[model samples]
Target: MKYRLFGILAVLFFLAWQTLDGMVEGDWGRLEGGLANLSIFFKESMWPPNWSVLEARSYPVCEQDIEFFCSVGYLGMMETLKIAFVSTILGFIGAICLSSLAARNLMPLYISLPVRIFLSGVRSLPSLIWAILFVIVIGFGPLSGVLAMTFYTVGYLGKLQYEVFEGMPSEPLEAGRAMGLSKPSIVANIVIPENGNHLLSQLMFMFEYNVRHGTVIGIVGAGGIGYYISTYLKFLQYDKVFALLLLIFVVVVIIDLLSLMVRSFVNEEGDVRKPTWLNTLLKAKRSKASLVESE
Candidate 1:
């Protein structure tokens, strides 16, 4: 059976790879042309550095006063990331709550339907639009970007979490209730424990999405790498642009690897089984013996 499964997987993988190769080959000319255009664009854009504006912006970056232009640009990126992180966390928590109530098995159609519609609406609005609108109220910076990302994440994560909740086996929940547990107790003791790993996985996955978006929101003045990118690119500083892009690439890749490790750790659900009564009592006795020994 294992061999059969592996064979099937190999065949499927080959077919998928072949399909992708065909698509890439079909677009080869277009891809090459696009690449050429991009190269030309960068070559043309990268001259005449805006040294004057850069000089005016000459202020201390992070209190060290390294260089004005670079510092401001970096400051903007830091703000962007701060917004993304804060918003992602807030949105994820909100989504967890909404997802719990929104699960079809847990709630009736009337309740779940409305929540789903609201979430859908939230998802419909692009984060960029939210940033633009909030930028008016907040008047720029990472604050607006964070708010936009949070709202969007709440919608997205809420929907996905509900799906996760719905897919969960009811047996454990039923077992908890059969012992006369309350709904909240069942959720706290069983639902959360069972879904803890899944939730962690989802959170790790969303971090990448948030980072990508954190870039976009910067265009409307949300801050982060985007602002610096815009500044250098506008001045035709392709080298600096490449430098910034390299930084983003490295950071994102490193974060992605860390997330993968976390996913692996969580998926294992290390020692998830509840402690047996005897095991707990035995451990307690051991602790008591150690205390007596100390005396």
Candidate 2:
């Protein structure tokens, strides 16, 4: 069995390599000196990132005691976070409604089919295209960004949620039916509670996805840090762009940590022992004792 698995993987890798080679026209030499070129580019254009992006603009009268509070990095990042938060929440609500209808186990085929088709249509357009469309429809701003992200999130998250619902165990649904619970009641009590962990996981993932894409959409004048990034790129201000990218990286890291902490609460809830604050403290103490003993 292991040998068969290895053989399958080897064939898949070979096929992938062949496909890539075909696309590149077998010009592997193009990779030669790539590292050296990147090094030179970084040194000449992006090294020693400009910290001025962290300083408040002169035209903006300094109302705050700290300049960083009014800095481009802070404002842009906060705007992006706000846009992501609002859109994720709106999209999650919309997705839950649609997904409940679309899930095969939750709804009849006639209802699920049309809703699935609609979700597919929505998901067909990339978020970037949605942003552009919204910008054209409503003039540029955060509003356009919000609308674009919300639409994309609904389609993407709806598919994930409905699939999760369909994959749920049949026993609770049957029990709900036996209990004469209506569809809404079943969904609220049985479906949602059973799938709480998965729903929360998808919610966090979609928020993170929207936050990253917020930068991309902002390049189209939808308002975010990407607006400043586009401006810097236009002026060949690679150092400032690099600094902004670093700031984005830091913000994304913080969001990831936040997601991890939030998910930790729900992760051990079912058959495993649920962790409380006191239990967590005790566990930490136990770990410290174990480490000391090993030492």
Model 1 misplaced stretches (Cα beyond 4 Å): 1-33, 42-57, 65-74, 269-295
* Candidate 1 to truth, TM: 0.71
Best model per lDDT: 2
Clashes of 1: 4
Give one digit per residue, the lDDT tens place, for model 1 in 1-295. 9999999999999999889889788565566678788877767764333323323244433344455435544555466668778988999988987887788877779988999888989989988888888999888777788888999899889888889888999899778878999866776788878998888877877777888778777777877767777777677677666655655676678667767655555564324423343434464575566578789
Name the weakest run of 10 consecutive residues (lDDT summed) in model 1: 47-56
In the predicted model 2, the residue pairs found to clash are: none
Which candidate has the top score in TM-score? 2
TM-scores of the models, in the order given: 0.71, 0.91
